[model samples]
Target: MASAGMRRRVEAIPGRPLPYGILGGCTEVIDVEDEHELLGVEWMALGCCPVEVWNDPCVGADESPGAPAKKQFCRPTIEHADPITVYAGAECGTMGWSYAEARQHAEASLDLGQQEAVELGFWTNHLAATATDLTPAEGPVDIAQGVAALEGCLAEQYGGVGVLHVPAGAAALLGCCNVVQRDPGGGPPTTLAGNCAVIGAGYSTANTGPGGIPADPGTAWLYITGPVVVRRGPAMTVPDRPGPSINYRTNTQRVLVERTYVVATTCTVCAVAVTTCPS
Candidate 1:
């Protein structure tokens, strides 16, 4: 027999609804340290500046059997200032390649992609004479000699906000900034785990960033951006138990904001304003 009481209760229940910011996105700067440009061209500090990078979407587990499998690694979804990525590190591959070669390869990649090099951090390096005020020589050069020459050119060119990437072997050449060397020798061409930043001999630090140095303290983690936000609100809270609770104080919140990102672009590109791309 049908129960009228049960039917009344069911009818009294409210309709279900969805929420926002669940899959939200932020258009921030370049995620990683790739294709980044120094504000005025002299990247001599451990300072952190806005960089332009790329972000690749993950493939669904069952959607594309032919596509590359997604990593078991954790991903974020929140709207970030640099959604593409950030790090003292990204992923370091095993082989070591020359800085010049790498730069050329990166440039080739742009050409292959038909990319217009607006004003990315991508640049050509020269070991000029050493001086705060530098004038880059266009003659034949050696990394050591080129570095000395670079310093002179840097005085007027370097804003001290970007990372001065040198030949993997020439990092020690520049002498204006405070630096505790990481990779003493030009080891293998390695990359960071999260941000894909190439460090060690390839990068010589003269400055630091708002988040301190870019070096990672963990063996597995090169550098972490921000894992500082923890939700405590009752509405967004969940119990501490029950393995996979989404409504309670559970543990899978990486889904709530993990995969999302923010892409912050340069405020101005060569005085024209990169913000012109969009708001």
Candidate 2:
């Protein structure tokens, strides 16, 4: 077993680069220290000034001028980033690979650690979201259905089109059913039916089985979009030394990485679609 001290050593790994993934595309990333304050008042704080005919068709000059009512929003919420980690172990005996091989293994572990941080934080937020925000559609949402769901939510929020995140399987289905517009050079689909940027969540439950989100047999294709804020705390340290495990008798050394993440919604309307995609 790796001790708490060993975990600290992992956090101290020098030259560790921040990880990137699809989450970056759809979220507002903010790096914070101990805690972050989400000012709820920032969302729709200003109201549109009421318009009236110059001739006082709407109201008489004797009446007092109307005041712009402030938009109602949630109170400020304090969020703390939570840690998520991944580890890899290798044998220290002669049977173990050479130093170069062990180093490569550690590097691979680091990569996985970074990916896990992004994917876990992204999906955990999705799964934890209220069903109303994370709306559920019938099984297998088509292009038109997906667009309606996404656009409806955006309208509710008084926001224009936003990024739409779908599972890989759902993306494939949409591509097959609709002519997704892409750049001439050929890359990921640039836009879906509603002129929305489509991102296939490669690490979603539908794609990664149990490793990603827990399976919900009732739901098939799930889509999420809106004003999402991802708050990241200090990056976790990677264990520099593959120290032998204190509990295990075998001469096994391990590397571990961990980081904190908090996913939040900026407004009342965060759209999500859950539908069935037949096998």
Candidate number of the best lDDT? 2
lDDT of 1 by residue, 91-192 (tens): 112234333333343333332321111111121011111112221233223333333333323322322321222322233332223222333353222112
Clashes in each model (backbone N, CA, C under 3 Å)? 56, 6
Q: On a 0 to 1 TM-score scale, where does candidate 1 land against the true structure?
A: 0.20
Best model per TM-score: 2
Local distance difference test, candidate 2: 0.45
227: Cα error in model 1, Å: 25
Task: Estimate TM-scores for all models.
Answer: 0.20, 0.57
lDDT of 2 by residue, 31-83 (tens): 76544332211233221222333453344544555663344444443423334
